[model samples]
Target: MALYKQLALGAGLAALLSTAAHADLSGKVIGFSQIGSESGWRAAETSVTKAEAEKRGVDLKFADAQQKQENQIKAIRGFIAQGVDAILVAPVVSTGWDEVLTEAKEASIPVVLLDRGIDASQDLYLTSVASDQVKEGRVAGEWLVKTVGDKPCNVVELQGTVGSSPAINRKQGFEEGIAGHANITLTRSQTGDFTRAKGKEVMEGFLKAEGGGKSICAVYAHNDDMAVGAIQAIKDAGLKPGSDILVVSIDAVPDIFAAMAAGEANATVELTPNMAGPAFDALDAFLNGGTVPEKFIITESKLYTPADNPQGEYEARKGLGY
Candidate 1:
């Protein structure tokens, strides 16, 4: 009887130790609302974020908004209802986020904006992890201006989604870049919805309005997918891309590197896709009773031209998903 009692006591103590070790996490849950897998980069971001959460032993609740603002709002409210410890939102648009964010703040839940920017007051959210979109546009524009110096150039612009931050900032930055360049003018500007199909449609319209490539000197796409789509349109019109219509854009996806290798694309600005590393780091710090600043974490971007795209380095990075 004495030996049996000692054995039972040892078992109870082992169970108690195990429970205490597991309780170190404080049983925190993280909720993430993604803006749908519209692009390769977006899909990569979602995948990496999920993997990061799992690796960190965070109970992550994920919601896909299917690229709709209403869906995102609904998902955020759901997270609030579930009383998640933290929430991450990749908003579809810049506006219409203040109310949902306010609710999270009221609940004392920290919200992080990922890959996109919001127009609301900064106090509504904790931090934003995104690329300097305007700077990306400026880099592309500078390359174009240098390539076509002193020549009267008519350019067609393939903008991103109508109200997204990348669309707004890229447009503004490109306009700023070409401000004093008298010889370069934007002949056509339209939204491509950040997809290849819409990019092709918009490019076809630009070709018809500008009389094909005869009058159009270049194409400036907000993303590589659009640029790739426009390349097909240029080809179908019997014009040689990179030679007849110089192509420049952002997002160094694998396809764009292929285009550059084939001489269909002239230049691109790279936007890295692996945003999960920094995001998880920030969240871990915040969860450990550490205060994080209102950070506007900007990822580094590089301009890639044919002269520098050797052995398909852009293609290799594209597999990395952002």
Candidate 2:
């Protein structure tokens, strides 16, 4: 009888908590600091964030930092000054946020990290929502491992912006995934700045250096956009992307799906842009007396291959502005 009473009380309290959370966030103001729309993924993220705020009836104040750390810091201070209810920052660079985050902590305005994390004390922010970058790389690596099997594979990697967390973690993850694969090796690697033009230029140099692209077996780009650019480079050198040289990358953007459908690319790991949906959920829960969630809330890192209906995937993402 005592156990039953405890269970009934617990249920009641849970329902009460749910009600409070739902009530606390209606029409609340949220400030979001985004790393500028440097890529299709970032643009989609910004769009999705706005849609989420509208759906929840929350007033959202957005700032784009133009891919600079100082601009991001300035935006954060501006949000704090405006007395916003909560702050969401997808930090441009990881290290320089301790002081600004400290100010937010002192003001008692809970700050949540969206899509990217800052290098700071955990207590400074409410929680972080992001994709496991290393895992994304590992997924790409694993696919190539399975595809190549026992064949000797020489992979040339096109890394993202140097020193960015995604570039760092993703490279580490791919290395970890291919650790024991003796038949596969990374021969040459360079930074593409996560841009198509740079990816193409770097790949052109790699082709010239590697016996007119014959010495290379595969291309491992940090993102699908780069892989698409690399495909053009391979074709210019009289090599077929899927047959003569395999192409694998992270971020399943719509262009990548088009590449896959046309047989110019092999596989990609997805990095969804719906980061704000989870961020808002965590913010609401915390504002209504719920404990801060697990520090790291990882987003999905789904893999898409040509065999999984590339045309359908392309069509789905086309309207999403990717």
Candidate 3:
């Protein structure tokens, strides 16, 4: 009888160990759908996210959406089909996300938005970790207003992707900043797809339409990539950039700091690219059944000018590792 009791106890212990091993979440898989490498910041985001997941022992399944909304949707669905524990998305556009997010919710998997946001119901996703894009634009606009004073500045704007949240909110906030200043007018505005090539093409058109840069006082771009492109356009047309045409933009990329140090660009709003750390922190909590606030995270940003663009700081802030 004592021998039988010992055998039963050993069996129970073995079953408990098996259960614990099955429930161990250290090797859980996470799905990450990234918008394609559009700029320096985007590339940094991708690198950091992968590194963080690997460090945390997460099997990260990644997909590149190539800057297309449809591609992101397909990737999200694929993650769901594969039964990943959680999913992360940096949406290419704000709208058209509710349907796929609903699918994720139905699958009992949590979703986290990275740099960009979606215009879905709050309950559909876990949380968003991103900078306040509208505020970034407002900061840039305020700097322009103070610097240009009451000087009737005719502005040429370089917008981002057509339907992205950053482009829309940045334009809205900039318009608000210049609202009471009747002398500040946006003479020409066009989408540059947030790329250097497109920004240059659109700026060339603006220069021609304004009769070789005499009519424009400043250029406000949604991101530094576009601003850099516009600066090249100004130089190619035989005009000095900062002196001939003032430039203000968002995303304080390393290249933009170099431009500021060279006096080619005026100001930029800093959009830090280290979003993955905070995202994984939040995900860990949610997956562990901890209660997460609906709007759990937000990244802070600041404005950078030539005076503040120190050499060491510029090098350290180049790519998003923080």
Give me the candidate number with maximum lDDT: 2
Which residue pairs does candidate 1 place in steric collision? 272-322, 273-322
Alpha carbon lDDT of each predicted model:
0.76, 0.80, 0.77
Reference-based TM-score of each model = 0.72, 0.81, 0.72
Compared with the true structure, the alpha-carbon lDDT of candidate 3 equals 0.77
Q: Rank the candidates by lDDT, best first.
A: 2, 3, 1
Clash pairs detected, candidate 2: none
Q: Which of 1 and 2 is ahead in TM-score? A: 2
Q: Distance from true position, residue 90, model 1, in Å? A: 1.9
Off-target runs (Cα >4 Å) in candidate 2 are 1-25, 66-83, 95-100, 161-165, 208-211, 319-322
Poorest stretch of ten by lDDT in candidate 3? 1-10
In candidate 1, what are the lDDT values of residues 1-322, reduced to their tens digit? 0110000000111122233222223356888898887656676667766756665677889999887899999999999999998898888777999899999999999888887778999989888877777888888888888999999999999998777667887888788888899999998899997778888899999998886568999999988788999999999999999999999988777788888899899998876554544565566667775868547766566777888743456555555554
- The lowest-lDDT stretch of 10 consecutive residues in candidate 1 is 1-10
For candidate 3, give the lDDT of residue 317: 56
lDDT tens digits, residue span 41-77, model 3:
6676677667667767889999999878889999999
Model 2's lDDT to the true fold?
0.80
